[model samples]
Every structure is written in C-alpha cells, then in structure tokens.
Target: MKVRDKVIVVTGAGGGIGRELVFNLLYKGAKVAAIDINSDALEETLKQAGGDGDKVSTHIVNLTDREAVEKLPEQVISCHGTVDGIVNNAGIIHSFVNINDLDYDKIKLVMDINFYGTLYMVKSFIPYLLDRPVGHVTNVSSMGGFLPVPGQSIYGASKAAVKLMTEGLYAELKDTSVNVTVVFPGGVRTDIMKNSKVEGVPSTNDTDKAHDHLLTPKEAAEIIINGMEKDQYRVLAGKDAKMMDKLYRLSPQRAVSIITKQMKKIINK
Candidate 1:
C-alpha cells in the first residue's frame, strides 16, 4: 500500500486534500493519475507540484457519470501504464437546511456525488487494482456521515452509505492484495462548501469559534496517505473526528444532542 512507485488514481484531485494528495504522492515517487471535474483546477494542482508534475497524469471527468467513471482505469493505464490504488476523496454537502425544508433534488445531488460517485470509482477501478500485486482504496466519509448534523441529515445519510459500503468492500476483499481503508475526517479546511455551491459561512466549531476546527488539507492528506501505506483499516483525521467517534459509540443520543446545539447556530444564522 505504500504509494512509492505505485500508479494511484485520485478523484477530486483538483483542489483541497485531493490536490495535496497529488503533491504528496509525487513526493513519494508515485505515478499519480489525478482525476477531477475541473480541468483548470487540475492544471493548477500540477503547477503547484512544480517539477514533480512529470510523474502525474490529469483527467477531467465527472464522477457522477458512470460511463466516465468506468473509462478512467483504461485511460489511466494508457497514461501511467498500470493501476495500483485509488483514493475516493470527492464528496459534497447540501446547503445547510433541514431535510423537511430542503428539496429532494438537493438530497439526491448529495447522494449521487458523495455516495454513488465513490461507488463508481471503486467499481470501475477495482478490477484493475485486483490485477496488481497490491492495491489500496481509501474512501473518505465525513464525521457528519456518522453523527447527526441538524441541517445536514441528507448529507450525513449519503456519507453513512459510503461508510458502510467501504466496510463491506473491506470484508469482501480481505483475502485479496487490495486493501480497503475508510477515513472519517472531522472538520477540514477546504473549499468544499464553495465547490458544492453552498453559499454562506457554516456554523464552525473552530478554536476561534468562527471557523470549523479545521485541519489543513496537507495535514489531512498526509494522515490519509500514511494510513494507506500502513494498511490501516480505519483512519480518523482531526481531534474532533476522534472525539466524536468515541462519544457517539458510547452514547448516540448524547452525541446527537451535542451536535444539534452546535448546528442550530449555523442553521439559524
């Protein structure tokens, strides 16, 4: 699972942690196939990599399109020669609104992008990955995916699906060279809200109380890639995600109550 010399395919590689992963993977001497919906952003990621960009391949495609997702492995192999791993890091959140007040289309959008998009990448890439001597798949689910956030119930449900799906994949692929890692990140400092087209500031629990206690994209990517190399079954990024995982495991009702109090401020604002 070490990324060194591995041909790894990364979705959402245009920005945020995905962009950071491209950089770190290059630093590790991995042949990276960077996939994103935005061509310009993907170029920017390559630009940031400086000379290391030579080791990377950039693909602009929408994960929501099954055909596009399915074709990625072949395109990557054609460009990078082989596939060894994949990072399902693309995801989005619905606008901060209660389920009752939100449109069902918004819910579907979240589900399609966050849950099914990850699924498409996994299904399309797994056959190729299985052909390798060893491969790893890292699926990013949110803390919201597990714990209840008042205005983000639908978003939570979608990520919850990803959480369960990835675990199921782990069980099925346990005997294979392919490894599965499910990541739960707390609050990451990224442009995901803006990328998701969600306007306005979120109710943040940052130390400053103005931003989410956000882990930088590079920090989060390092933890994730390191976890993949170590073949960890689960990786929790950020202190908040670790704390919430423990709290929710011990008392789901209490956890939900705590989240509601914090989220109410954001939703009402």
Candidate 2:
C-alpha cells in the first residue's frame, strides 16, 4: 500500500513501536488516528509527531473493551473521512510464571488485550475496509509467537493466536481488496517491559545483550511498510526474527529447545 495520503489508524500509539510507527507514517504523509489508553503518553506521541493537529488525532481507548473498540471505526472515520489501513499494535504481556502458578486474572488480562483487542479492531474495521477498493491490516505479533518462551507463556500464546488469526484473515481475504500482514519483531529498545504485566519483572532493565541484535522501531516500521506495500503475508523485523522463523520452519522441536535455553537465563535471573 502506498502510505502517502493513506488514512491510517494505529492502536497503542503511545508506546514503543506504535509511537514510532505513528511518527514514521506521518512523515510518509499518512493521516493517522493514534489510539492508546494512556492520555499522557498519547500526548507525548503527538508532541513528537510534530504534525498539524488535523493530520494526526489521538484517542484514549481501552482496546480490551469491545464497546470502545466497536466505536473506533466511526471515530476514526469522523476524523479522517475514510480508513485505508489499521495497525493492530496494541498489546500487553503477563509476568513470567509457570502455567500452574500463573495468575488466572492476569492471564485473562493479557489475552483480552493482546488477542481480543486485535480481533475487535479487525471486526470493527472490516466493513469500512470492504467499502474501499483496497485496505491493509498490519498486526504486530512477536518472535515469541513462533517459539515458546517458558516464563512468558501467556504472552507467547496471545501472539501465537494473533499469528494464526492474521494468517486466517489473509487466506480468507486473498482475492479481496483488504490485505493482511503479520509482523514478528525480535528485541528492540522500548518501554514494553515497563508497561508489561510480568510479575517480579523489573520495570526497567538493560537489554544490551538483546539490543546488540535488536532492530530499531524505525527499521521495523520500514520493513512493515514495505511488506504491506508488497502484500507480504509475513514480515520479519530483524536478523533474529528471520533466523528464528527459519529455525522454526526447519525444526520446530530444536527451535523450541534453543529458545527455552535462551529464555531460561533471562527468566531465572
């Protein structure tokens, strides 16, 4: 999809990759509707975007709430006149814990925000997209979506659900004007940890080891934009993401073992 002049709506626009995506899309001449639960962070994103208020609009919405998500299309349409694309970038991660010991409430929270949130957005926007000749939906899954991470099982499951759901949407919409793209992003410098629900997990920690192999949000956004333009079904955001996808494809068991070993060190710390 040519991002120039496209009317785009990005959820979780207050944080990390979402914030970067909004800025990048704005620079590419897309009118953006930025949505996040955090008003302050949304304001910060707007300030950083440096676009005319008319070019960028912000909405404080709790994505997990189906009612709120249901209203998003109308709200976005009111602001942009039409919706050409949507980035389901809003997500939440639960704390690292064995399934047996995991807090059910927290797990529900994660699933609601990460899984149902994506579904709600897609459900609400598909009608509008169908009206147009072409539309795009870019969902941000994670490297964990392909490989199991012991402590972050809930997060992994949520993203895995997203992966499959997105693929299903792609297969079903292949002949249509709407396109679906799923992204698997490896480590990146972001505030996700601070906002995540990982119990006993530090709000802030050095990700230097991961950063060495991390793709900046700008890089990831570029890859995603290109993938959407080319109508790619999957977009791997970094070397690590691509390698992991390859490994999982060649040997699922071995890939899981390797991811388990690497994640053990982080979770056990």
Candidate number with greatest lDDT: 1
* Residue 86 lDDT in candidate 1: 93
Q: Taking the tens digit of each residue's C-alpha lDDT, what string does model 1 give over 13-109?
A: 9999999998898888898989999999999998888835458889999989999999989999898788999999998887887788889788888
Error of 1 at 197 (Å): 1.0
lDDT of each: 0.89, 0.87
Name the TM-score of candidate 2.
0.95
Q: Show model 2 residue runs off by greater than 4 Å.
A: 202-210
Residue lDDT tens for model 2, 189-258: 6668778744565433465554466677777777877887787889988888889889999999998899
List ranges where model 1 is wrong by over 4 Å.
51-53, 202-209
Query: Residue 139 of candidate 2: its Cα lDDT?
Result: 90
lDDT of 1 at 212: 46
